[model samples]
Target chain A: MDSLDDYQIPYGLMAEFDTPADAMHAAEQVRDAGFTRWDVHTPYPVHGMDDAMGLGNSKVGWFTFCCGLCGFFGGMLMIWYMNAYDYGIPVGGKPNFSPFASFPVAYEMTILSGAFGSLFGMLFLNKLPRLHHPLLKNMRFADVTHDKFFVVIEADDPKYEEEETRALLKKAGSKHIELVNE
Target chain B: MANHSVPSSVKIAPPPEELERPALVENNRSLGWISDTVAGVIENKTPGWWKLTFGISLLVSLGLPIGLVYLISTGVGVWGLNHPVAWGWAIVNFVWWIGIGHAGTLISAILFLLRQKWRTSINRASEAMTIFAVMCAGIFPAVHVGRIWFDWWLFPLPNANSIWPQFRSPLLWDVFAVSTYFTVSVLFWYMGLIPDLATMRDRFRKVAGKVVKPAAKMRNKLAQFLYGLFSLGWTGSNRHWRNYEKAYLLLAGLSTPLVLSVHSIVSFDFAVSQLPGWHTTIFPPYFVAGAVFGGFAMVMTLMIPLVSLYKGLDEIVTIRHLEVMSKVILVTGSIVGYAYGMEFFIAYYGGNPYELYAFKNRAFGDMNWSYWWMIGCNVLAPQFFWFKWCRTTPWFIWVVCGFVNIGMWMERFVIVVTSLHNDFMPGNWGYYSPSWVDMITYFGTFGFFMTLFLLFCRFLPLIAISEVKGVTPQADPHHPLGGAKH
Candidate 1:
């Protein structure tokens, strides 16, 4: 029993807020207080919360743009290789390969690849499909999907001091605070 | 300045002429209420009507396989395909179903880009409709090609013969366009569903804890596990949402053009051809307008009853939503009417005798009844929406939507059959009508569509719960309910 208890580590401290405004204000405090490993959780993506949390613009667009370019050129190359270079059959006296004719298909491919990029990029950035997390086991944390908002400051954060962090969260207006364990 | 200071106790009213827009979610429903209402539909016991409808639809949906088997065994001759009227109900049904899919994309993608907050409540179900409708549409072109096995040749894949698909051909372009549209729509729909699925996962977890019966508990546990699996362990983290939102916005941006291109390519199937009526520059825009017109009608057709049948849905999918959709119908329907007139003007003004004859034949030929039906339903039915009473009344909107649905179908029928029935040579002229297999298969698609939709409604969130909450006043940090000072 002592060995098992020794293996357990404190995951984070979670602070519950009644509304998004309260959560946003707390996030601003956490940001200003220089907490690096902390997160705000809410039912939906609250407007202006990004700024409050000090998050810059998301990087998902770069993946989409690069993949979209590949899709378009890949589509064009496939057509050019299959029709013009390899088989070389002409119909209706038109050219074996014309970009005009291939534009629609290539355009479709661009969108398809761009869509793939957006989804996969998001998943990659979020480190999702993890299926397990410390906060997920916390019963009170479940309300983050319903109506409640929560801010979690990880124990691993450099500036994390148990008493000082707890006091700061209390001053930030969180009525309930609990320690989550991993 | 002194006079202005004397009004401390007086109350000033808002300007009478300024009309406040109706709230997106009625009755100022709380966030918990929104989640409960939406998740409750799936978590509660299955309704009798749902079971009955699902059973009937499952049974009726058999006609698709039955008709396909018979058609495959007997051949394409089973359909009403004469020399001139070679393209028949199959093409018409394909275009009709595909067109019906457009409104879903319009709502989910286009409206999102335009920042129309009202679209949040209806976008999920409609996107589901788009996917199913595309499935129905895909069946036609795949089967219409006499050899079903050879349908794989539509792609640019390398085979033994080493021949590639004609990139210039509109028929091949359709293969790429429709396939891409379907794939993108599913991706967008699934992405949107992730957050909502997380909500269901959490709720089911709670339910599993409360249930004492082992078997019932097992079922709840299974549901929770499946939802949790799909939800990808979403924690509603703002860091995750930042990327999630950007991805959603990009998808919406991509889907907007993809949706427009899909119908345009479908229109190209006709327009690129040398056939007098088929070869026209106006085909793309006209077809797009008609697709939007028909798609909204299908949305209304599905949503009106859904709102009424499902308890608590009426508040989320409010009368304002219906009225706004009705206005879209009126606007698009009028555009379709304008296109109809423009087609005639182009035919006469272009001074092509065959084009002239085709237009005249569409109105006065043996198939004239369909043309008039198209006119009555597509052009005139939506005119009722101009009246506030018609727009506000659910039953009236449903009835008008029904006519618009029929009218849109008739419009496709007239376009496909009428123009083709008479060829360049008089000897090629012949009357075309669908065989029983065509009718049954077409009807079966409705069953298939409904079955898929009913299953979606039963298992999934009918309304986008997270998105709907995002639009609510309570979700606003500056709003009083959100704890901001006035």
Candidate 2:
């Protein structure tokens, strides 16, 4: 199913917590309980969610760095080929092949590259400019931007079972969960 | 509905006009010191140092007319121009002074866009620096060519007489670039000044009786008249700030690129040429980094003390502001150092003989002392920012900033002089130093720069009183206990 909640959860399983510590404790219990397809969102950043979620570090910065490199070289080649090689003028006895002279233009390229790289890289990797999204459609999910925290266990989880998942949620002290739909 | 929905009939009292003059703080004999002291300082007209600087600068500005008359009468032969150095002191000073203007814009526009709050107090003075510094810079190239009459040839026109300006020429590109820079800079400076001018106008209106103090009633009256002319009598309503702020953003958007291009094209003048030292790809950012480095150093030199002298502004100007500015110095200085490293690596790795020799000569050649001094001021002095003592202490920070300015100037001198004096051919190598006229004119620009800045400090609200008030805890201080101003 395209929707995350379309799957299910175990009996009385509640993803619950008052403190970050409690959240982490319940998160470990949830994971250990074979709740494989779930996500945890928090009020403030928690320290070890990546480990808890088994997620890897992001590749966004590396993409930006590559873009910056492209800019630098692009700038260098433009000035060099145009000035020194293509239409060489020997002003003040400077050699036609002066790489030293090609620098300033190239430096601008580096900045442009880095800036553009960061911008486009961020947009591309985040899959932005989508005008509409399935998640943002949910009014409850909207409140996620504010003071609320949520832990979502999908119907697709290996331990997914509707009745058991509801009981499991209740047992774990989740304050509430009204079903979110497409 | 009438009582609850319509709101209370009780008039919510308006807050006091200033921090020291708050209704709560006033009427107390002890707190009277704050307002009495501030009014006292503001009341005392421009001080001795200001008049002295103004007198000197006015005298030096007269030098421009005198020098122009001399140049116009005698022709290009009056000044020393020889075979190797085609672009002499005039161009050199233009680049140097324009480079000096860099820090002001960076402090105001770049830092403001980045949301640095402390820039409030010093940004006014630094923006004024940008205007005055750019004015001095704009003058140089105007007179550089022999026939000042035919200097318009540099413009890019598609006319029949000859042909298009060589876009290939960095000099031509510089004409496009620097003029754009000056135009955008003036616009940016003026846009920022409008809101402040309105504030001054309001203050003058409200306190017309007390205005006889700082200036003669005449100058204060002149300020009021000028503000009316410029602002069209802006009435400090929300609508005015909204429109003014929108215009400010447009100016900022225009300036960001102009700042980058102006220095980049300047770097092109050397980097496009095939001179050994000048030709390297590192030059553009290196020069920009160096330009900003020098500019901030100049800003630091003036702003540190000036902020302390102005009343109530110290709260806004704050130690944190200088500390942050010092960090920028450290970061840009490091970028310059990194550029130097890349130059060294590329020089050796590429195995170009002329390039290697040019760089080597700059460091180890006869003028090596200048080169070492450059490294000491630019590279070493900035490293001090790593220490809290260096960044936190105002006296120490000022001294180090002075060194950074010296270092940056030396960097420009080393770049211009070493590259020109010695080139690819050994026989063509020669020495160049500023003559008395060159030295005086250069110092005269400083006199001009300081003269404008000093007058700005004295006559204008040195710290933007309105803007500083906007940022203070009285405006938007983080309040855990309450929702609004305490």
Candidate 3:
């Protein structure tokens, strides 16, 4: 098995850093190097790392906005359909359907659906709940949720060159760099 | 003489006024220290105090089920509901508990939006409090309807009766507001917990590997798997964090208006009616201010004790946090005081005899003692927070917060009972008081709330570990501790 190690599949090269600054600086170098298939990992979101990585704004707000609009209209329509159209009853001598009467419920529904949109939309975008990633298997990677930070360049990146990438990571101040197995 | 002898060249600029704020996490604690300290409370063996408290709470919590069963078996008549004062302790407790829930959102959502870094230490626990308080609040109206089974009628569900809930009604609006509030709070809270849960999962895995005993290993394995499952296999990838941060911001924004609306809708439950004391245009903002005030007081009441009980939590939840919270209490408490005065001013200036009489009755009538108690507790108790001694002393803050808690309940009592006990017609007026059942049921809710909170403290991260670390100077990329050039 030891002799057959060369045949094992490579997932990516992971470079570990003790501080967010080092990982962020490495991300800037990687971004400048024009690597598209890579990510930085840390226990918390480091401030200003998005620009360092050259990533654009997150698209989550659109999901919330669209769904919130739907919820508001849906709530209004539901009230109108149930009370005014389907089972009309005269109690307070007011109009059968007034937005004023329905605004509170509609507003609440807007928030409810908007929240759902934010959570599910975020999950959808992240491609999460994968449960079985090569990164999860790496003992060194576990610190990503503790105190350490990481930068991983996928083996599938077009500019991939094993030695060259390793040298770049080493140059960027990572003391520990290892190849992750798929 | 020494000053006169000093030369102009030797003159020193008075030390630049030290304006740098206190650190959110005291003692410049490291990231690993933050995680270990927070997760340690859950990972360590249960403390003796926790066992005793949980045992007592579990015993007391049984009163809720027993009281509910008896109430259901007998009838709503078992409560202190009378003809004129139909709404009683149930309504008062509902409003009070719901109001208590508001501080969590205010801290988590409102403070987050405002970029108040100190909130990171207290947000998770307070959010849990909000969820539990809302659960307690939900129970009252559900059972108060006299027909527990028919509570489903509040929703716009299809029914054989071919009747729909009145949309114009504030009661129906309450159904939407509270249920939405609960759902959004849980979502926002769980979303924030995911990364921390991942930390717990990884830590449990590390412990599981080191442990030798089968029982210990199995426990750790179970914890690891549970935390991992809920964590959604979080790897702290920047890609995920990007989306997660955006979602969090959006949720915070959405929740701000939702929190304000919830209490406003609750106030509408009374304000929409024609009752002299109840029908005030100032109800919405007044209720919101009161809710935030009571909620912050409850947060202090719970957190001050927890900070002392848990090891190393004092560094995370520092005196500065308590003092800042006390200032918030003072501000909101003053707003409530203003509302109180404004209500009376409106009552007099409006010149309606009934309104003026209602104000007079509340201040000097049979239930005036409750009014005075409300004033003393809600209005005056937090005034002590203006003093640095009172704000910084944990025991003093705790006592004042206890007063605020009781005062808030009194405020609700004065609002619900006083307003209802005196109708326009002399014949319709009557005195209202709680029965033993009402007292037990309300007491039982405290037990239920405490039981849930204790379980949370024992099993879950009591502080937001990741958020706290993010606020620490070490987490700042440009800070020297983060490897930046000095």
Best by DockQ: 1
Tens-place lDDT per residue, model 1, B327-425, is 999999999999999999999999999999999999998899999999999999899999999999999999999999999999999988998998577
lDDT (tens digit, per residue) of candidate 3 on B88-117: 999999999999999999999999999999
Candidate number 2, chain A TM-score:
0.71
What docking grade does candidate 2 earn?
incorrect
Question: What lDDT score goes with residue A11 in model 1?
Answer: 95
Model 1, which residues run further than 4 Å from truth?
A1-6, B1-20
Spell out the clash pairs found in candidate 1: none
DockQ scores of all models, one per candidate: 0.59, 0.02, 0.55
Ten residues in sequence with the least summed lDDT for candidate 2 chain B: B477-486
The C-alpha RMSD in Å for every predicted model, in order, reads: 4.0, 17.0, 5.9
Looking only at chain B, model 3 earns a TM-score of 0.96
- Winner on lDDT (2 vs 3): 3
For each candidate, what TM-score against the reference? 0.97, 0.65, 0.97
- Separate clash counts for every candidate: 0, 25, 0
- In angstroms, how far off is A58's CA in candidate 2? 36
Which segments of candidate 3 are over 4 A away from where they belong? A1-7, B1-17
